[model samples]
Target: MKKPFAIVFLLILSSCQYFEKQVPDEEALLQKRLKEINWKEVSSYPSIAECDAILDKELKKQCFFESMARLVQEKLDLDTIAMLYPEMDTINVQVTVYPDASLKFEPQMPPDNTVSYNTIAIDSILKARLVDFPKIEPAQKEGVPVTTQFILPVILDVE
Candidate 1:
């Protein structure tokens, strides 16, 4: 009886190691992928309302977009990215086309009430652009490049 019990205990312990999953090293993967990122074509886009929200919020805080506009990088979906990283100042986005491709107006924040889907944000930190990263490397599936979208945080100097 003792021998049988010992064998069973050993078997259970040995099998537990097999249940553990080895997660892929994402940091190394991102570094390699960002190197492959084509940087010549980034752009910025914002609907009047979208920019306004950021401006209104900032201005209300006594930090105007005009004074902080230089720090804007690109716009991103706050709701979407915020879910992944609760403390992230910005989201991780990749894209091939520039959001500024068709934006001909001044790079200032939008006024009180215009809305646009292509628009993201500009804050005291960086400005973000909205674009579709045509191909997300190492596709989620084994054979297809998943169209993963994100906010590519841009760093700028407001001071």
Candidate 2:
């Protein structure tokens, strides 16, 4: 009776190890699949009020870009700047739209390009743009609001 009981206990312990081995592999595969997905690209881009009515995905994207361009052009005062460099024809503005619908814009110089402008003037211009900033609906990934980066190219055609 003692020998039979010992054999059954050993069999039960061995089966548990086999079940444990299967779990790790399944867990590891799940982790790998999650990492493979790109979280940056969302199902839909962030929208302004002007883009809210657009149902088509591609058209909505275009409307978002156009609305952003119009907003910047309408607010930034180009006439206030006195260009110190004749070669600089463009300014690249990088704006990070937060999940809470606030924008943080900064002027960044490209690696191969040069920018010559007063910081005070640029700050004032950006401040004016923010005054007219639209109420933003942030980008969503899997139905959760996400922060997004937008780059705008402003042509400096100062006469």
Candidate 3:
């Protein structure tokens, strides 16, 4: 009876081979997955109410960008800025929009053309105009909200 019991126990122990060490390291696995993600690319563009009715993907993106441009032009007194800095033909503004619709305008880098103004003045103008900016439905990757960057070209009429 003892010999029989020993044989059965041995059989049970040998049959229960569940821990084969297939997963080497949980952290490593997570790192590999993270590496595979393209951080620069998003699955969807940030949206606004005006763009919600558009059905086509490419068209929708175009509409969103157009709406942003229109909003900025309407709010910002570009003519006044141009008068202050007559030499600058173009102003390239870099903007980053957050998930909560907050915006961060990067410090203006003086363009190649010759025009100088107080950084504070530029910052104030941008902040004030942006106050009227519509609520943005933020960009997403894997269904998670992400910050999106935009380079807006403000062409000044140098007169």
lDDT of 3 by residue, 1-159 (tens): 999999999998887787554766899988999999998788788899999999887888899888876776655654466677666556667878898878776546575455456778877777766665778898888899989999877665544
Model 1 gets an lDDT of 0.36
Pick by TM-score: which candidate is best? 3
Residue 14, candidate 1: C-alpha displacement in angstroms: 1.9
Q: For every model shown, what is its TM-score relative to the native structure?
A: 0.20, 0.67, 0.70
Candidate 3: stretches off by over 4 Å: 1-36, 157-159
Q: Name every residue pair that clashes in candidate 3.
A: none
Q: How accurate is candidate 3 locally (lDDT)?
A: 0.76
How far does residue 71 in candidate 2 sit from its true spot (Å)?
1.1
Worst 10 residues of 1 by lDDT: 133-142
Please state the error at residue 106 of candidate 2 in Å: 0.9
RMSD of each: 19.0, 6.7, 5.0
The sequence of per-residue lDDT tens digits that candidate 1 reaches over residues 1-159 is: 999999999999999998897876999899988787655422222223224455343343233223222222323333243333233443222322223322112223324254332233322222334333222122122232233223333332221
Model 1, which residues run further than 4 Å from truth?
A: 19-23, 32-159
How displaced is residue 43 in candidate 1, in Å? 17
Question: Candidate 2: lDDT of 54?
Answer: 91
